[model samples]
Target: MACVAPSSRASPRRFRLTSTAMMESAPTTRAAITAARARSILRAVSGNLDVPGGEPLGYADPIGKILSFNKLEMNEALPPAQRAKQLGADEYPFFGYPGWERNDAANRRLPHDYMHPPWAGQTCVGHARAVLNAMRAGRPYPVKAAISVASNPLLSLADVRKTYEALSSLDLYVVAEYYLTPSAALADYVFPICTTVETTELWHGTDFCVACPSGIQPLYERRNTYDFWRGLAVRLGQKEHWPWENVEQVWDYCLAPVGLTFQKLVEQNGIFGRREYKRYEKLGFGTPSGKVEIRSSIFEALGCAPLPVYREMVLSPQGDPEIYRQYPLVLITGSRFMPMYHSEWRQIQAAREKRPDPLVTLHPETATKLGLKEGDWTRVSTPKGAIRMRLHISDMVDPRMADADHGWWFPERKEAELFDVFESNANILCPDDSELCSPEIGSWPHTALLCRVEKE
Candidate 1:
C-alpha cells in the first residue's frame, strides 16, 4: 500500500493499493483501477442493477441504452444561473452523472422522472444535504418547502439528530407514504400512498418489460406516487405538464417509442429484447474519449483523483488515537438486515418474529473479554453517538470488530418517543459529518466505522 497524495480533496492521504509484481504491467493488469486501462462504471437506473440478469458488460438495461426516450435535459434547459444552482451539484460534480454528467446516450436521454425526484437524481445522499443547505444561513438553493415520497430519513440517513434538525427546519414538509414513519410523523401533512401490489408499475427485468398488475384497487383515497404528483400539478395549474391521467397512460406514452402499448405489454405478458455485448464498440464508451475511463478525465477535470484511493476511517483507531484508548473495540454498521426492507416492516409481526431484536454480532472471544455473553444488550458508542443492540456471539466478524445491523425501531412504542427510534437504531451511531463522507457525492461511510461496545 503506497500512500500518494494525488489531490487535496480525496483525503489527508490516499493509499494506493498496487501489486508490486504487476507494477510493470500496471495498465494491462486488473491489480489496480488506474487511469490507464480501466473503464468508468456508473449505474444510473437503466434497471437490472442487481436483478437476475442484464447486459454482461454493464449494469444498465439494454432497453435504456439501446431504445432510449427523448427526454430533454431539465437542468441544461434552465438559465445559466439556475442551472449552476442545482442543489449540491456544483460542489459535487459527480452528482450530475445521472443528469448530464456522462457523455453517454442512455444517461443524456433520461426518459422518466417516475417515482424519483428532480433534485436528487441517483445519489440519495443529496436528500439530507439539500435540507441542511436550506437551513444554513447563506447556502445556495436552500430547500424551503419539500415533499418526500416513501422514504424514512430518520432510520435511513446517518446522524439522526442532525437529520431531525434539518427536516424540522423545513417550512412546508409533506410526506407521501403508506404508513406514518418516524420521519413522516414530523410532516406538516401526510398523504397515504398505495403499495406496489395496489399500484400499477412497469417493471423492466433483465431483458424483458412487463406491467405489474395491481392485485387490488387502492383502498380508500390511497394513491401511487405518480397520482400524488399529478394531482398536485393539476391543482397548481400545471395539468398540461402531466398529460397522462394515470400510470397506465404514462406507460403507454413510454412504450410508444417501440410502437407498443401498455395494454399490449400486459396482454402479451412481456416483451424481451435481444442483448448485444459489445454495443460500446459501435456507440463507443460514455467518456469524452469514447472508451472506458480507468483514470476518469471527468474526475480529473473536477479536481479529483483520477484513480481509486483509500482513506482511513475518520473515527478509526489510527485516526483517533486518544478516543481509541477508552473505546478500544472497532464497530461496523449501516448494513441491511434480512426478512425486512430498509427501515420498514417493523410494524409487521411476521418480520419481527423472524429477527426480533436489533443484533450486533461479535466473536465469542471478543464478547467474553468485555465480560459479556451471548444475547447481551450492548451499548455501542462512537464519537458521534450511541445505540443499544443485542449482542450475538459469533465468529462471522473479526474478534476485534463488532458488526451492527441497521434499521431497527420499535413501532409498538408510543409515537411520542418517535417509536423509540433512538434506541437500537444503527443510524443513531453513524454521523454524516462532511469529513467522514465520500469526496465525489458526499456519501457518508456506511461501514468500517469505529466504536466501543459495553454491557447495556
Candidate 2:
C-alpha cells in the first residue's frame, strides 16, 4: 500500500483506498479526502484488540522472516561460493582500497562477528591498512575507544572488558571516557565531549525525516568534533592532507561529490536532495541477481546460514520458560531518550533534573501486586550483577515487562562505580558465553532479558 501526503502542515494520516479507484478520483479533492480519511483509517486500524499498548500492529509476527526466507531460497539456488565471490567482486569495487569499500570488506570478513567492542575487532584487511597508515604518518591513534561498562552489551561485559583489556595491554594508546562505570579509566587520556545540543554543526542528514537545515551555535566553548579533528590534524603536521582548510571545507567536500555546492546547500538551509533515501539500500546487496538474499552462498561457504533465522538466545528470558516464572518481567535496557545519548546528558543540570539517574519502569498492575510504589528505589539483579533505581509504575510497559533507563553516572561515586562493584553493571547479569550471540550475525541479544525487581 502507498501513502501520499496531502498538505505540508497536516498530521500524517493513512487511508486504505483501492489503488485503481483512488487514481481515477479528482486529484485535489481526493488528496484532501485521503488526508482526512487517513485519520479515521488509522484510528480504526489501531482500535484492534490484539494490538499491544504502545506497540504497532504486526510487531511480534514473522514479517521479516517471510521476506528473508524467500530471498534465502533464491540465493541458495545459486552455486555455492560463486555468490560470495561475485558479491565481493562487484557492488564494492573499492573493497581492497582505503575507503568505505575497505570498511565493507572488513565487515564482510566477519559478518557474524558483531560481539566485539565498538570498532575493536579487525574484521577486514582495510582496517589493518588504516592502522598502518596512521602508524606510518606518525599520527596519534585515529580511533578513540570509549567504554560504558554500566550498559555494555547484555551478553557479557566481562568478556568485552577482557577483550578491551587485552587490547589496552598492547602498546596502543586509546582516548577513553566512561559514562557510569570506570571502564575507560584504563585509557592514557580522557576528554569529556559535550552532548549534541551542546555543540553545533551544519547537520545534513536525512535521519530526522525532514529535509530542513538546522543552524544552531554551540552552547559553550567546548570543542566541537570538527574543530578537534582539525586541530589534531594540524598538530600531526598533516594539515594540507585535509582539504577545505576548516569544517566548512569538509562540509563542502561532502556535498561536492554530488552536484550540490557547499554554498548552495547552506543557502537552501537543507534541501531535500533526494526524495527516496532507502536507509538500508547498501547492505553489501548488489548481486548480479539483483535481489536481497536471505540465504547467502557466502555464509554457506563459511558454513553458516544466509537466512535471517531467529535462534533462541542463551540466558534470555525467552530461552528459559522456567526463568520467566521466577523473574516474570522481561527487561529492555540501554534504550536512549531524545534529550540524551547514552550517559552524555547527565552532566547538564537541566537535563539531569528532568531525568535523574536510572529509572525502572514497570506495569502498574505488576507494581501493585509486588507491593511496590512509584518513586520507590528498587533493586534489579541477575546472576551476574544488580543495580538499584527509582521506580516509574506505568501501563506503558507490558504486564510482564520492565525497563531501566541506561547510561547514568553518579559523579560523587567512584568514576565507574554503580551499585556494588560485584553486582552493579547490567552486563554482569548477562552471560558472557557465546551462546547469547546470534550464530548467524554474532549479534548479541540486548533486548530480551529476564529479571526480577524488589523494593530496596
Candidate closest to the true structure, highest lDDT: 1
Error of 2 at 181 (Å): 8.4
| Per-prediction TM-score to the true structure, in the order listed | 0.81, 0.56
TM-score of 1: 0.81
* Clashing residue pairs for model 2: 14-38, 72-295, 106-124, 181-416, 182-416, 294-306, 296-306, 386-423
For candidate 2, write residues 367-422 as lDDT tens digits: 99989999998998655457778899889887877787665455445544332333
Q: What is the C-alpha RMSD of each candidate to the true structure, in Å?
A: 6.6, 14.2
Where is the poorest 10-residue window by lDDT in model 2?
A: 61-70
Per-residue lDDT, model 1, residue 71, is: 42
Runs in model 2 with CA error above 4 Å?
1-186, 192-221, 227-240, 257-260, 274-285, 337-339, 412-428
In TM-score terms, candidate 2 sits at 0.56
